[model samples]
Target chain A: MTGASPADTAVQGTVAQPEWQQLDRRSIWVAPVQPLAGLLLAGLVAITFRGWDRFGVIEPAIGAAVAIGVFALSAWHWRTTRYRITPTHVEMTSGMLVRKHRSVARDRLRSVDLTSDVVHRLAGLSVVAIGTGRQGGESDDELKLDSVTTEEAERLRRLLLDRGSRAPAVAVADPGGPAEPAPLARFEASWVKLAPLSIMGLVALAVLAGGAAQLARSVGGDEIWRSGPVRGAWDWVVATPILTVVIGGLVGLLVLNAVLSTVLYVLFYGGYTLVRADDGTLRISYGLLTQRSVSIEERRIRGVRMDEPLMLQLGRGARLRVVAAGLGTKDGEGKEKKDSDMLLPTAPAAVAHRVTADVLGTPTSPVGAPMRRHPVAALRILLLQGVSLALVPAAVLLMLALVGLVPHWIWQVLLLLVVPAVVGAWLEYRNLGHARVGEFLVAQGGPAGRHTVAVRTDGIIAWQFRRTVFQRRPRVLTAIAAVAAGKGTQTIKYALQDDVLPVARDCVPGLLDPFLEPDHP
Target chain B: MRLRPPNNPVHPRATTWWRLQDAGFYLVVLVVAAGALFWVSTAWLVGVVAVIVVVGAVDIVVTPPIRYRKHRWEVTDQAVYVRTGFFVEDWRVAPLSRVQTVDTKRGPLQQWLGLSTVTITTASTAGELKIKGLERGFAAELVEQLTAATEATPGDAT
Candidate 1:
């Protein structure tokens, strides 16, 4: 391990690379493949040329011309863009007609992520996206350095966030001392089984199976059904008894979803690894094809979230996520969701707690903390919502049945479902709970998922309190703790007036001073 | 049916602000009702309009005072506390450190009445907290104090 003075390194860096460093030549190749829409458009054109009646047979020369044109245009775009890096800031100069010069200070830089798609991987290049810790509507704060060499991408990740100097790029001391990063956590084989248990998986399977059936009926013709494997499965379905077939199909679909989701999980997170960098940053790299590396600064992470999906909850499985800012949360980018604040995919309950404790630097598990329950008003509201919603159909059917306009069975069916509706609402009210654990506030609730989010109180930026008309009678209101990180707001619905104030006081202490009269929520 | 709120309420002059806004609303409604007066077949539409106008007139006259009483706010060294709404009251407390922007807006009607709306923005998902119908001078003072407080607090580590 070498500890080079960052100041000395900066002086040496200017002589070698004067102002800017040019990207790899392979970027020109990647440029054409960058916009996914272009590829999709090309596919559409090819399909229409072959299948559409009006298009008829397309000449091969026209196809080649379009391909060459797109590639040439992309190359020209690549030629125009340039960038410069100093110890303090990274400056970018892009665009030909409308010039764009974006400069980001090294200290202000939030997170550096490297991503590679099928095209980028094939070309041995990666796209780097650097984000600033700014909220939405501040889009210009991010820098997208596309199609850099894989090695350069790695170097940039370390250098841009070096904090010390541009020349002494790597950290001075190798604390871990391992030739490779010691894997803090890895996806267990059992995580695949969780895919089947989730409602989303079941719903997706149903949709897929329905689509296949529809496709078989309308498009592909009898030859598709005669295919060897599908034929065997179809024959078995037909041979079984009607009741057996119905039950077996459901079970089969669940199994298929489990296997499918597991395969999907493995493909995305097969070599999943969370490594602690020498500088205390947690660097995560994963995915089978579209390799991605995400770096989160130690201080940026506020807390952890534990989600127990209903199906997975039964089996003691949970998913873990980090509560942090500067992780892309807006809906526009598909990359954000893929590489966002994910700490772990599905894992056992114990493992989830262990990882959370490790991340927060706590000796005890994050789970099993005592929580404060909502007032009875919450239950009343839930029951009102559930019963009133369920009764509307029942009343309509009953009225129609009295006039002999509808069958009596309709009313009976509606009546039969009412109990379950009320029970579901009650369960939701029962789940609503909030607690203050040391410097963290745990907001937990939900009928199905039972989401438990533990956020550091210091990370909370504001508090919003609500007092509804119905809740007034029971002296209860809702409190929303807004943080700059993650989903942004944590809610504690139907809290008593006495309870919420203390919670607010605990979260922000002197933020809501005693000078102000006791507020509603 | 009202929820018990904090002691410090909005400016007493806010009733004038509410009444002015209510009058403007009623003016629009009256214009439409007058136009409809000629087209009704059985005069039932006119009857309904008369009933609505009467109820609205009562609401405009009686509700402002209730609203003024319900609305509350207080500024401490570290945060801004506000409770508003005559029916569904909402209370908000935002730390000075989290304060991103602060502004005071005065609409034409409010300008005539010497009143302004104070808006406090934080990095929270709940959006902005606004205390409407404060004395113009008080609102300005609030903006200045809040801005100073925000600047004094250190950078958010997040």
Candidate 2:
């Protein structure tokens, strides 16, 4: 209902602003629209199939009408939808039947990320994704401009950043100093090739094998190539114990695939650059198939993580990821989604740390100590597990004997439960240790493989001391550490009751005091 | 760290009531289980009536004389402390700095009694601390106090 106001038409700088009418008209068919239309058509066709079974003659005509109706609705919606960016806010108005209008204040804008797929490229239009924090009770804000020129996107970004400085909480650093662009670090796609290839290939092979097995079962038939002599021969070839000779042949093929994909992606993202723009914005641009450019305000980053998988660790390579608020990186569990903030999948730890520091606006020091389960706690855990396992089987056997159902196998059942319980208890005992380093507490415990959960003193949301009836008598308690990662909580449990309070205090000063009174202490 | 008298009248006698109620609940559960067991043992319809009568008599005898001791929170500059437990006595304290949000609610019974429940949420993993059965006027005052403290304090990152 509101037309573009006089303020919206004001162009910054001397750049000539193209008349709104001159912009590409085809931008209406954004990435989602085409797929959505296609889905609607498919649904119509399915409806037609049901109609044909009921009333044969009118089905085809009805299907055609339905298809036309869907297409018309999509076109109508696309034509009516419009977006504009003023210096103060980003405005979007859409919906044909039910008109909706939304706007985000420029100052509240935290980041702008641009992504385009094949469909977007073909249309010669890109999507500008704008993110903003919640103010008042409003939760999340995102604005996606369906069709916009690259130049227009850049102009909008600059204008928003310019206006953002005026807001109360938005602080804009001065860009007066001589621009010292960091030396462009050249990383060959070939250097860290083997790790991704082998991992991906193994996963692919597993998936293919699973699919093939499922298909074979469903068909209830086996082909000669898949299940007969050829399969056996293939298995024998792969099973050869000469590790060097066998893997040596496959390594080239694996590396080639990895390098090929990486090179393709790099080529598509030819002008890939991560630079601090004049206004202190971290701008990252990359594209091969569909170009992507993202700019994030430095202060918005909450934390940084350097992740090293087993193979990457072995190769002395670590991936860097930034934990930026309002980035929408979280999945259902509030864990950061994979491929989100993947600055570099395989970079030197030093470079990773430097980048992380620059992005997060903090010193790149590891914040927390790894917590490990106490040795005595492990023994107790083992005992507890052993008792639980023993009791379950003992109860089952006693019930069976009382019912005269399986009285003969009571001793056998007891033996079955006891042996495994003893082994499991020993495994549990071997995996407990807790330690404090500086202001971080690290707790490690599990069976066989250990998990070390580290928490910074300041990051802990709350600490709880829980004791069961048995534990209270033993003077033992479980301490749980809660950390806020996006929406959900990350909890770390330590089963050492005796020394947990003191260690927690040392790691996180003033943590235990709030829960305990001075007079009582 | 001055401690003021509890805003709500602390009933020390409630502890006895709490113990009795807990015991009574367990006793009722035991009687029901016993009645079921006796009914299973007996084949005659009259035996079932006998089992029911015995359970009812036990429940009636154990129903009264239940009382519960209560404690109320006294807010300090740094923390709010509430001490209330029967056999396993425990005290809870929540710091103002760590407090994320303060919520107040009154249930049907609490409303009838002019009492309210105050919940304090912290960033800590322990979740939230709740102090219930405080006077309505006291709860409002506590909310106002906590909200002001939260706003006055600078955001602590670490």
Candidate 3:
């Protein structure tokens, strides 16, 4: 019923009707793991709350029923799922009852991703997803294949992304270049040294601590507090000098955070590689256990953002992410989404610039170019804002102290925080800069770590200038370059109107001309 | 250096429309505050009601004309320019080549005032540029002009 038209067949060349392919048989084994794990976790929670001695056959019987149901559904899904790649479109038909058919035009294909979690990896299967750059309803836009052989996944990625310009054609297209070039970037083992600088370890630690706390609560909170080692530690903590104990705890936490972050870094980016294939596609593949590879047409990349956390900046490290249309923001999309645009994981700043330069096809990275600093009035405004923010807590604490509800030193300490706030605002002002280099508009700003984004001037669709009443006195405004990719807006926050107007005019010639008035002498 | 305001002003009825909208919002607030009088002291209720009424009156009276003056829009062959907001003024410009869609919307309030809002959208996630409260006929013309201009240009709008 869902057959191709004559035009589709013509576009496909000799193949009139391509044979529909089945998912790898191993997917049935892989699919049940998720549902079974969920059930198992529920059972474990129940057992923990009820006590192990109360464990009965009822739970096992329900677990068995769920396991069988999930297994049968998985087998049915495997049996019914079928997909085919014609010259014009990649099509998939799947469903036990609803019979859903999804197809994406070949020309509109924006990305092809292959991700394998631990279960799929163990089963030697990969989930392939093809994106066509449609906005809204992320799941509906992509054609997802639950599980396929790794080899088949790679073949599909190559075939879809590198259709017109294969390796030989690319060599012919650029006679000066080699047939196969080295990868643009690769993981360095020493990168783990910089892990402690990243907050990833602290984030993991927080998650682990939260989970452990929840689990302990479920298992009975009193039992843990009454336990021998915990009780002994509690007694020790009570007996120790307060300052000494606080310092020791901080030191231990730092050490633990360092170790955890390092392990997480290794697990997340163990074999990271960013390669621009001969056919002009950027391929990024990484991960230790649950491997993921994403291939995006290089032309789709509108810009790149180099992220430098305060600690990472101190270590002279940065992370690079591609600003592209198809890959949605990590948080904007729900969790379990494998759309990652990380061109280079946390690495040396120099390495990040080099990779960025290579990827953007510029002689030198635009982000490193000399930037025009924001007006000093911007610094003054930031200082005022930061000081005012700090004053709020100090004032509240002072009122509490006066009422004898809190210690006096607490408010004093809170007041002292103004110094750091001032310093932070100053750093942010120092980082406030924008530059137009070649065809890229680069903007860098942040309170702690700087984020320097270099957006392709042509990618910018519009310009927006915002000025609050407070900024009118300084003749300062925030200029946002609205592009279709990445976060979709690159902002030069708090710049003099004079500075940004000309920059905006030059960034995309004539777009802002209609709105700007003549400059006064 | 400052941006010259866009060339066209919205319909005069826009002020009345805005006043009605603000009045409706303040009415709801007044009702809520009056309800809360039963739960709290009369002094607190009076204070809350006074603040709300004062703000609402200011918003309804002082803001409408200022907003009407500030809100302007212009469309050239090359681009669409719009200026909006009173306290926090904003100027936006989108090239015709990058405009993906042009639409006109009219709420019940706007319909009563014979006003329509024309929205110009680009592929950018910065969102659409809306020139609110234009005469309905003029709004339609603006949408038609924008649609034609965007259609004539030949890019993916990305």
Best by TM-score: 3
The segments of candidate 3 whose C-alpha lies over 4 angstroms from its true place after superposition are A1-15, A34-52, A96-99, A136-140, A165-180, A330-333, A336-339, A393-420, A519-521, B38-41
Give the lDDT ranking, best first: 3, 1, 2
Model 2: per-residue Cα lDDT at residue A308:
52
lDDT of 1 by residue, B42-145 (tens): 57777878887998899899999989887887776666777877577787777667788899998998898899999988875455788998889988888888
lDDT of 3 by residue, A1-521 (tens): 13333234334365557678888888998978976886688677667556778767876887798798889999999999999878777888999999988788887888888999899888788998787776534332677788898877776776677566343442244422475567888899888789888888888888878977887776677766776778899999999999999999999988988888888889988999888786778989899987988888888999999999888988999999999886654322344453467788889999999999999999999998999999999998999999999889989989999989999998888888899889999999989999999999999998878999999999889999998888898899899999888777999999989988998999888778767787573
Residues forming the 10-long window of minimal summed lDDT in candidate 2 chain B: B1-10
Arranged by TM-score with the best first, the candidates are 3, 1, 2
TM-score of each: 0.82, 0.61, 0.90
Q: Model 2, range A98-176, lDDT digits (tens) per residue? A: 8988877766777777776667777766667776754112234566666576655555566565542333212232232
lDDT of each: 0.74, 0.55, 0.84
Please report the candidate that would top DockQ against the real structure: 3
lDDT of 1 by residue, A1-521 (tens): 11223343477445444356566678877767655454455446344434544353454456567778887877776877777666567788888678888787777777788888888998889988887777656232577888788877776777766665445446553423556666678766767766556555566667877765665554344645566776898888788899999888778877877777766677777677787776657887788888888888777888888888877888888888888777665422433445467788777888888888888877765544878988887888888878888888989999999999999899888987779878888878877888888888888888746888888888888878787677777878787888887777888878776786677776787766553354434
lDDT of 3: 0.84
Task: Sort every candidate by DockQ, greatest first.
Answer: 3, 1, 2
Tens-place lDDT per residue, model 2, B61-129, is: 443222123355557687655654333333344556767788998765566567677888764324567
Q: Docking category for candidate 3? A: medium
